[model samples]
Target: MKQSSEASYPISFRKREATTLGDHLRHHNSVVIIGMKRVGISNFLRFFLHHQEVPTTYIRNGAQLLTVIVDLNDLVEREIYPFWVLLLKRIVDTLEQSKVPGELKKAGQRLFTESIQLKDLFFTVDCVQKLLGQLIDHGFYPTVFLLRFDRLSEVITPEFFGNLQRLKDAAQQRLSFIFTSFRPLYELRPDVFSKSSLSVFSRDLYMTPALATDMTTILNTLQSRYNLNLPKAVVENLVSLSGGHVQYLHLALLVAKKLRKQPETREELLELLLKDEEIVLQSEELFASLTKVEQEVILKHHRGLPFSQELQEKGRYLWETGMISSGKKEIIFSPLFENYLHRIDTPVHGGTEFTKKEHLLFSFLKTHEGILCEREDIVSAVWPETAEMGISDWAIDRLVARVRGKLKAQKSSYGITTVITRGYKLVRTS
Candidate 1:
């Protein structure tokens, strides 16, 4: 079933974030927007471009505006030629498709037509440079939003980024650019990037938010989608239950549709939420989205285990990005997500139990299932902080014994063996 109107409206719930993005645009600062996967970065960019409230925000310092959005996805190829051409096309499309002054519009169309006929890289990029200059001449600042620009990580070369940077510099910095990516530009292989091109993005806007950041907008979406009209008490419980996650919000509405006449208890609501298969499946997928090390750290956190320094650093990132909750009782935020972590290690059929440590070790070993996990490798995975402090052979053997004992105690097909002079390997038993 269709969950909600989110696809059509797409972050119609994101007023505050929209405002933040607007402020960056106002300053003519080239900005880099960092957001996590499924944080709705793409849709937010889409909504920002055509959003009714956005146009009024474009005015600043008594100046007018021209904005163009060139989605990297719109480019048919990763080559520079196609990228520049697509950017030119979107700019020209903006001129033709928007309500710009007729004089500037006519000039842009004429320039774009000539550039396209040339079918040349230098000419196409030059057309873009000229268009921005024209907008400036006409008392307008040109802002370009490059959506999914991370795709250009490989497409970026010393020459391409260098030339683009020079174009912006040549425009007296009146030209603004906003690039959206799941990671920071430095993390995206800056080796090939020209330093000059990269430095103009002096502003970093993290679009990831606290659970409550857009809470009201979320409630409004659900309330309208399911025709919900509720008391303040119920709204409070729903807020606590949804944990600011949209999937949970959508399912909460579905559950509300079924049981609104019944009750408003938090326990009753959470029990119902955890029972839904969609919730569990989505939670599992979200868990899968994290890197393996992250998976282990978050899982250990949910179980209240001590973290190595590296995991602590990773945990900080996960928390800052809203993947986990704040403070001592840290959670994965969504109640459904919490449920997945709980059921992940314990077996379904024979009902074998693995302690959290045993589970993490087994998971790591299983990740390299059928391969050797040397003692040093084991120390790093199972004891990251003191791997350098040195673990004794008995410490390793005892944990292996405990894990091996549990596997056999449950009469499972999975088994492990010491590699005599080396380490241990997980294996299949007949």
Candidate 2:
């Protein structure tokens, strides 16, 4: 049984902080909440808006709002000009239809009639100001919740900033602005907003649960909401595999429920998950995007080994690109994605034909528990003289070294053990 977002993390478990939802509402006019997708940012928003008594208007797409602002500016520039006497009449007509208060409607008219410079009229900086002032005069001055501000950073021009500043300056003391972004504000537009201004942005309050807590919560919710009886051991295994990522856990449970022939059994769940072709295809597509070197490195690691120094460097680059992550001594896909990768066949090394290096390595390791062969023997067995010299004994050694590094990095209990005088031996510590 899968739990809904609300049931997964109880409100009581939420973090108590100086900058909590209630605290932010009390102190500031706006508060931004930024987080990874499915990390509960939206859930928190729902909870705050419903439970905190704050009048919150969520602007899901800042880009869309900016587009509207720009279109309005264009309309104003092209339509209302030269005839300054007629401008106020047109502005009043626009505001009357905009549902603004009578007082604000009159103020907008006055501002329009004034000999405002074209530069100031269409300035991006002043746009926000005019909009906010209009909203306030219309009695909409509580708080402006700007979600996904990263999208706006792309379209926000100097003129937009000028208009925004005017709004900010005109806003009442209680009017506060909150902006949410997936990335840091500096990452979006460092030049436009200062570090001091960015500092006012609140960090996302993560609702991450401990492994045990997550497992317990998921099981409880599943049992209560879906009337599904899940075994404690199965729940434990699922949580362990999921790394406490709520989305993965929920997906895993949903998969198990869909294949409901002994959903309580770990082996049954594993079989269903492994045979999921859609999951495998998605995983393959992700792996395919990686560089040849990175794919080779990861495949090697998946086959219970690491890559050479060159390949390791390539793998590191992939990690930085969010394609992979390094654990203790092993290279792994991100935790949320590790299970998906494990379901697919390990890809082969590049420049080498469809040679059975993975099969040979696995078979060799299985057959020779304590036995070690000379370096020459590895080259002869894994790759004959017909094979390219680039993948010769030295190259094989580098591959073995990479495999060893990965094993050590992963801190695997069972790993390939190097034999100084001979070659290598697969040791099963467990």
Candidate 3:
């Protein structure tokens, strides 16, 4: 949904004293803002820049380390360089007025000496230490703002960290360093820096995409920003489907809003959700990644009961990985995923033969609920040539018992039921 410029979502700042950038800036000289992509790291940085008075310099992507150093030197030398150039020009003008030079005058000999000697010198470790000492003498302290430390980790080599350590040692309290990373610091090499000098903000400390609390904040923001009264149920469903990932939730809301603008009814919202290309693509990808055994389990469970041993194993794996939940003996995929699965065609497993006779037997029992089918009828439906082949009644009884045992094992109260003498019936409790 396109929100007006005036419409801004109120960011829910963490309640803890030292959590946010503003809060940390007030107390600590250096603060690191880190989180997953789209978790509002940039927004937080922008917030502090807008609200606070500190000299904020954002190092975007952190790839241009050398450029940053050159820029810093240029900033330091701006005033002096201009004045020096002006003085040289003035001296040349005075000499021309005095008519001291002939060819120098004809050539308009304007001396422009732009020296980056000091800047080039700072590239060396010893020279950088000396430069820091000179800056301290001149009361030119700098607070280094290193944005996207994750990007830096990718771009910079091991020598970069070594040089950074030297820079830190040389500057000491005179320079404050703020490093931001998307990934966890622990995931990186530990020998990169001393723990005391570094500050880490991880998913554990900050709200992660999977958290319910973060999802609530996102829902509230969407409602307030769009001025749309999103139903609580709708928000909950979106949260459950997206697993509280902000980008995914935003996409869902955007699609819903677009559909709502078409003057659709509330009931049509579910259809809108289902039809959204973003959701459809993500769901398809999720289903595609699942194993064939897992798909079989889902399909078999959806049909009714009698799960194969392989299906049960896959179900247990899915449950452990948080893809689904097991209730007693019943396995349930998440509602969102289940709905998506229902919309798609059944997937094929290996070419294992399914008993058609078993299907017919179950179908007959299901059709005649609470009524037993005769042995002759059962044979006719399940095994057509059984009478001619002289298949005993015990064989049919064993098959029924196998079906019942499977049902019982899966904790399904439905399936084949005993009828004492006549035959079997499917008990429909629901």
Candidate 4:
């Protein structure tokens, strides 16, 4: 993040993200970038490679950058051997295409050819390691970018990642990688990450909102293609509706094309937005991309209600992703979205939706339903990450009261029974 912002603030949203990757590469660190669905990270990486932001701007210490991009989306075999083969091939391509000395190119070609002939994963990795070492020795810092690197973590064994970590460690961390995936690293592979160095992340870039220039570029392109006028006011409402999501922002225009001829006010546009099937689906999808805690924070904040500082910390993701703007008052950026949130949260019975804290308390109590849930245990469950912060008794009682009220309102089969001193337990109602 320091690297991304150290330079002047970027006018292009993805450039800001790209700048962060460049900074990490300069420091010899690896980064895994994730974005929400339909955010078009593929195009973003394509932009990075074409622009040469790293080679042209970063890398000032008399070292050139060696970039090998392997778009994993093209992988068909789903086997480790094929994966390694594809990666080595790309490194060879990068070496051949980039302006490196003939000796280095020859060395890379030799290893690549040998890896192809050997048919062994370790051998292929060894070949890659040898070339990376050669590049560094020749005043080049190598960075391998794995695009659409979504499923590799699921398919590849832990050994493959261990090898990758070793490769980086051997480089003294000079070797860096950039991975673009649909899901963030935290959600991508939490299982294998538990016992691996991949968990030691330096930075994670979420799908960012389109900058002002980006929105203008899209609108201009659309105006010329469709031969329809893009009104300033209508466009403002579209940005609000789409929350800076480029594809959906463009889609919003096409969806509302019929209503564009008239001077529809923002409220009128929102009304149409709620009824349009396509727009409704788009809004619901954007909402669904958020986690439960994220959902609660946004809903509370959207309604001008106060959100806890801890929960607000979670909500920072919303601003980073461009789902909301933090001006004088935080804006949800889409009125139609409020309606969607309300509809989904409508209680199946009398049970209203629980906020993040309430949900935490209820989940713990229900998990220990028949047994006594000690106060200490509840603290661990509800605030496991911040138990050292020391929640007050009043705060705990307030949380419990809220959960009890929700359970009673829903007429759930379960109820909370407080023990005299130690704890609480769930009891069945008649």
Q: In terms of lDDT, which candidate is strongest?
A: 1
lDDT of 4 by residue, 132-171 (tens): 8888888888888887676475575668777777878878
TM-scores, in order shown? 0.64, 0.45, 0.39, 0.62
- How much lDDT does each candidate structure score? 0.69, 0.48, 0.48, 0.68
Residue-wise C-alpha lDDT for candidate 2, range 276-389, written one tens digit per residue:
532333344445445577667776776777467877775664544324444565445334355555545654343322124534554566577667755555655655522322
Backbone clashes (count) for model 3:
0
Candidate 1: segments with Cα more than 4 A from true spot:
1-23, 42-60, 73-81, 114-119, 193-200, 210-213, 225-238, 247-289, 327-329, 346-430
The C-alpha RMSD in Å for every predicted model, in order, reads: 13.4, 19.8, 25.5, 14.8
Residues 21-102, candidate 1: write the lDDT tens digits: 7776777788888755445565455556655545575333555657788876555455778888888888888888667789
User: Alpha-carbon error at 359 in model 4, in Å?
Assistant: 39
* Residue 147, candidate 3: C-alpha displacement in angstroms: 3.4
Instruction: Give model 1's clash tally.
Output: 0
Candidate 2 displacement at residue 66 in angstroms:
21
Q: Lowest summed lDDT over 10 consecutive residues: which window, candidate 4? A: 1-10
Count of residue pairs whose backbone atoms collide, per candidate: 0, 26, 0, 1
